[model samples]
Target: MTATVHTLQANRAPSLEPMMALTTSGMNAVNAVILDRMQSKVALIPELAGHLIAGGGKRMRPMLTLASAALFDYPGTRHHKLAAAVEFIHTATLLHDDVVDGSGLRRGRRTANIIWGNPSSVLVGDFLFSRAFELMVEDGSLKVLKILSSASAIIAEGEVDQLTAQRRIDTDEDHYLQIIAAKTAALFAAACRIAPVVAEAGEEAEDALDTYGRNLGIAFQLVDDAIDYSSDSATMGKGVGDDFRDGKMTLPVILAYARGTDGDRDFWRSAISGDRVADEDLARAIDLVRSTGALADTLERARIYARRAVDSLGSFPAGKAKSAMIEAAEFAVARAY
Candidate 1:
């Protein structure tokens, strides 16, 4: 388990750091408001839903929503509602994911499923999903509903594909990209895109934000896959090799398999494909990924996406908000550390 990202420091933000601190300060305020909104409803489903709220997550979805709104000169209360909406949608997914994965630990703590059980988690997830729909209807906009609904559908499709594709071990870059775009990038795209519509940025501006979010989300997933094979369990908050153990093939593993030697390929096929693995298999998998230089190459690909995210900011004017977005993209990649 290594935490070093070769490209993590490539983007140096002179003022972006301070602006990020400000963004985070604002994030805390928004978190409180959103948490309050959640509390009003969690009492009915506390065992499953409350644990998810108290659980640790980066809250990146709402950060994108608020930051995008701020960038478009939105100085109104609507952004708060939208931010909370993004959170509700994201939290709902986490609840469902834990149930689907049968995960016992999240953020180094017991998952809602482990504490309360799967049915509770699933029902509470349904509750949050319905709550998000209710909030979206309050906005009275069809476009918002369309984007979020599409994202939710894509997320579900991604989960289904992952279930079917489990441990195929032949999962290629295309399949890996598709699954992640559907699973992770869909929410990120929605979060960044809805702001332009809420702020009434022109169609062109809205499209740019959508592209930015999609690319940034892809980059984030790439680093996450790298971390699965590289980072220690302590920092990752879940088992280091859970991806393989759970039969989910990601970019790093796919690339490593392609470039590995005969012995490397055999070890992975037998040990990883079979489910139960020794520590030596984990070590060998790490070595195989490193031996093929896949980690460095994949990290470079992630860097390109981060650059694309910054480049998309060309559609926005100069402001602290835009700077924070650039910083957020960089920070996403740096999170590998």
Candidate 2:
């Protein structure tokens, strides 16, 4: 059998602009709700929330919720509030994550935690989480509340699991996957699944969308991990090797540690466990990851999940929304950052 070689450089997936265009109107509503609900007499609440919200993320999660609902031609406006709620859930997580990670930058700007304080960031995250629930209640659907609430709980558990696994070289691929699925993919699944519920699209459609989101979420995180070791700060928004310095047991590190020689393993352990790592150490770490083929393998794994995400949409009818969704999955793995 002929051998096949894969490279991240060769993957040119379509942009997400088309999907955003498809849901532009719905997204407008979502944004409006986000702005409206973020307001408070407290003043600082909106300032802190708006700082992160305006900081130039793609808002991919809420877009997915809106697009999935559009896939079913959902006429109800409840999805607008639901999509805002999804964004609040996502933003809240980011705020809390920065505090947990002691991150200085996000989207190429200082993290909220750094600007305000850890206490402010955590409390604002709590506020957003509570606001998300309020929107869910306004939607008047117990099912929506159940799905998002479950996702929130799973995300917290995943964060704890990752905290425990941090700097532990023994952390395996399965454990890493479990962490990402819970911390990240759970929300993606809920965001997509909720759309069909609001549309009354029945169980089959709901299941299909759920599968799509779950797989896409996994692919997205895989690429994110790979980029942490491969890209520059300008391209990646956050600092390159942030994961390495933080001792995150992401897939690339896991694979490299598992496949490396004894000396290589020692280097990984020392580099990751150190209180502070120099630029040279990060460079050496990236070289080790590249030489072990871990980066390529991680991207290849992400490609598999992206394919699965697209395949999950097979049961849906052909249309603009469906095509955009398929492209969205492809974009998940193929994005540069």
Best by lDDT: 2
Candidate 2 residues 222-302, lDDT tens each? 999999998466667898999999999999999999899999888888876865488988988899889999999999999
Q: Write the per-residue lDDT of candidate 1 for residues 247-333, one digit (tens) a residue.
A: 678887788888888877776677557654777777877777877988777888898998888888875666667767877788767
Give the TM-scores of the predictions, in the order they appear: 0.90, 0.95
Which regions in candidate 1 have their CA more than 4 angstroms from the true location?
1-20, 24-29, 39-44
Please name the candidate that would achieve the greatest TM-score relative to the true structure: 2
lDDT score of residue 247 within candidate 2: 91
Worst 10 residues of 2 by lDDT: 1-10
Residue 251, model 1: Cα distance from true site in angstroms: 0.5
Q: In candidate 2, which residue ranges exceed 4 Å CA deviation? A: 1-13
